[model samples]
Target: FNDGRIQQLAPPEDLYERPENGFVAQFIGENNTLEGTVETIGEGNCTVRLGDGSVIDALPVNVSRAGERTLLSIRPERAEFNLDRLPEGTHTVKAEVLEFIYMGDIFRVRLRIAGNENFVIKCRNAVGQRRLRPGEVIDVGWLPQDCRALEAA
Candidate 1:
C-alpha cells in the first residue's frame, strides 16, 4: 500500500520491514491490536494517532487505504514483563497464570488474557529459585514501538 505495487516477490530487509498488507503482518505474528488513525507517512516509518490520543510511531505499513480507523497488531514476544508496576509509554495488560511448567532449560509460563488470548513466556529457571505457581497475577507490558500496526484483511 505504500508504493502502490502489488506483485509476488520477496523484498529485501528494507522492503520486508515495511510490508504491503496485513497478510505479511499475520505471517510475522503481529496479533495484538489497537485502533489508530494515520497521521503521516515517511520513507521507512509512519505516525499513527491512536484512539486513546496517543501518537504511535511505527514502521511504514500498507494501510494507507484504510480510512479514519485502523487496527494495529502486535506480537507477544515483543511485549515486556512488568512485575512491580506498569511502565510509562507502554501497553499494559492483565493475564492469569494458567500453568508454570519446568522444561529443563527454562520455565514456561502459560498466561491467558481476558479468558481468551493465550501467551507463553520462557524464563530461565534458577538452580535454587522458587517456581512460579499457577493462578498468580502477572503484569505484562509492551512498548508501542515494539508493536506492529498492520492492515487487517
Candidate 2:
C-alpha cells in the first residue's frame, strides 16, 4: 500500500499467479489489472465482465460468485500481439499501442485498453512483428489460464 502499512508473504509462483489482493497483484510484477464483475463460474474457470463490456474468461483465484467484484491481473509476457489471426473464441481485446521499449529480442509493448492507459504486453522482436507505433490499435490477448482473477482490494 502507498501508506506502507501492509506486507504480504508468498512463494514466487503463488505470489504471481494467485495474488491475495489488488495490492499484492500490482506489487509483484509488471501487470495490468482491471476491476470487473464476475458473470459465471465453472469447474476451473470463470467469466468476468470488464469495464468496456468485454467479457473475459479467466482462471478464478479470489472470486467465486456471479456478482462478486474481482481484480484481474495479466502479465505482459503472457500476451500475444497481432497474431496473423487467432482461432475463434480466443481471449482477445483491442488495445492501442502506447509505446514500444526496444530490447534486443524482447520488447515492452505499452498499451491503452478500454480507456485505461497503464496496460502493457511484451513481445519478442525476433518474431514476425518488429515495429509498433503509438496510437495504433492492435489485437492483444493471452490464454485464459494465464489471466488471474484476484480479490478486489
Candidate 3:
C-alpha cells in the first residue's frame, strides 16, 4: 500500500499481470519504467513516445488519449532480445548490451535501452541459447499486451 492506503485488492496473479497504477506496478515487482507521452489511443492499445523519442505500443491501463503523460511498465523477463524467441510482427527497439551475468537458471542481462542504462532483460538458460557479450547491440521487444501504460510517477 502506498502511504498506508490499500491501493488494490486482488489475487497475486492479477496484481502482477494487471496492476492498477504506477505505485502498485513498482511496488509489486521489478519493472522497467520509462516516462513517455501518449501519442495515439487505439482499440485495446496505445502508442507512447518515450523521452528519447522512441515510440512503443502498450496496453492502455491508466492513459486515455493523446498527449497524456504515462509511465510504461514492463517486466524484465517479458522483454526479449533474441527475435527468434518472439512471435513475428513484434515491435523492436535497439539496445546495447552493458553487462551479461550468468545466473544458474537464467542469464541476467543489463542493457542500455531508450536512454535508460539500467534496463534489464532475463534470458532463460536453455539449450542452444546464444551468449551475449558486452558492447553488442541487439533488438529488444515485448508484446504490446506485455507493456502497460500507467499514470506517470
Best candidate, lDDT-wise? 3
* Per-residue alpha-carbon lDDT of candidate 2 for residues 1-153, written as tens digits (9 for 90 to 100): 447665467788987776766777778887888778999998789998888988888999878789999888888888887564445677777888888889887888788887678888887777567588897888887778888888887
TM-score of 1: 0.52
Return the lDDT, model 3, position 151. 86
**Candidate 2, TM-score vs. the true structure?**
0.84
Ten residues in sequence with the least summed lDDT for candidate 3 = 82-91
Pick by TM-score: 2 or 3, better one? 3
Instruction: Report backbone clashes per prediction.
Output: 0, 0, 0
Cα-based lDDT for every prediction: 0.58, 0.81, 0.89
Q: Predict model 3's lDDT versus the native.
A: 0.89
Best-first order by TM-score: 3, 2, 1
> Candidate 1's residue-wise lDDT over 104-131, tens digit each?
9877677775444456666666665456
Candidate 3 residue lDDT tens string, 78-139: 99987887789777888899999999899999999878999888889999889999999998
- Candidate 2: lDDT of 121? 80
Model 2 ranges with Cα > 4 A deviation: 1-9, 84-88
Tell me the deviation in Å of residue 130 in model 3: 1.0
Ranking by lDDT: 3, 2, 1
Alpha-carbon deviation at 136 in model 1, angstroms = 1.7
The true-versus-predicted C-alpha distance at residue 89 of model 2, in Å, is: 2.3
lDDT of 1: 0.58
